[model samples]
Structure formats: C-alpha cells, structure tokens
Target: MRSAIWVGAILATLAIASMFLLDPSLWFAPERNTLIVQTFVAAVVAAQLTLVTAMPLAMIISSLRNRTKTPLPTYIVTVCECGAVFKSKPMFCSRCGRRLQEPQTKQAV
Candidate 1:
C-alpha cells in the first residue's frame, strides 16, 4: 500500500512538472487535433494519479481512527514473611521457604 502511494506521487509530480516545463509552442506547432488529444490525455493521467495517491492516506487515517487500545493484565502482589514482595502470587515464599498466606477477611459484626 505504501509503495503504491510513492509510485503514484512520483508519477503525478513528473506529469505536473512536464506540463509546466514543456513549451506550449511545441504542442501548437504540431497538428491541432493531436495537440488537443495529447493535452486531454495528460490531464486525465495527472488527475487519476492524484486520486490514487490520496487513497492510501485516507485508508491509513481511517484505520487509525478505528483502532482500539487493549488494557494489560493486572498481577496480584504476594508479600512474604521475610518482607519480600512478589509481583505475582507464588505458592511458596522465595526467601523463607514458607507457604504464602492469603489475605484475611474480617467477619461482619
């Protein structure tokens, strides 16, 4: 998709530049019918190339707008008797080699 945009941009730039750089007299010196046909073809090509280059930009913007961010998982902290805090709940305390206890809840009075 990106490559297509670059190619279209380069082609459009070249077409526009050629239209400006080429001498008008040269086209007029040729047959009148040929001049008109060539001019029309050049205009159409430039317009189409411009449209092609714009499509990728629109697609990228639309995709970005539709994007959603996912939240990361939350880890439970387990504190050991030795005062070592672990980010995740562990079966046993690392330092004291003791079983970790779950938090105690108060009974309703």
Candidate 2:
C-alpha cells in the first residue's frame, strides 16, 4: 500500500512538471542553483518508482506459490515443503517417495 502511494505521488509530480512545462530558470533563480536540486529530485523519484513496481511483483510471486506447504504431522518427513502434492487417503510423500504413518492404522491399533 505504501509503495503504491509512493508511485502515485511520483507520477503526480511528473504530471505537474509536464502540465506547467516548468521553466528551468525558475529553479535557477539568480545563480541557476536549481540544477543540483532538480537532478537529486529526479533520482529520488526514479528510485521510488522502481521500488513501487518491484514490491507488488514480489508480493504476487509469494502469493502464487501454491505448492508450498509445511509438514507438521510427522517428525520424519522434511519440515519445509516447496513443491509437493499431499493426499490423505494414501498417506505418502510423492516427491520424496516415503510413506507417512497411516492414520487408520493408528486408530485401529
């Protein structure tokens, strides 16, 4: 949300500059001192836009990782699962090819 706001603010500033066709002399009033200020502000605005675009992309990738899962039911299986399909009826790790402790067996015994 904050990144989005930063992007909006930067775009608004650019629009303002283009709308007014802001004269460079105004910034340099008397001694053309606005050169340094203009360069610094431009750099800051570009960096902000870059971050604003990058953060949302990162958020999307993290949200799309549907295969990710955490193995907490057993101590023998790997802890963090990145890409694997889990089934309850068969009780097996498809990626590692290991059988999980059958719940039915535990109940029966």
Clashes of each: 0, 0
Q: Candidates' lDDT values, in order? A: 0.63, 0.55
C-alpha RMSD in Å of predicted model 2 compared with the true structure: 11.7
> Model 1, range 39-101, lDDT digits (tens) per residue?
556655666776777899999988987786444445455677678777776778778888866
TM-score of 1: 0.33
lDDT of 2 by residue, 9-94 (tens): 67656754663466755554664445445654665677677787898898998887844855345323232133453334446666
Which regions of candidate 2 are displaced past 4 Å? 1-32, 66-109
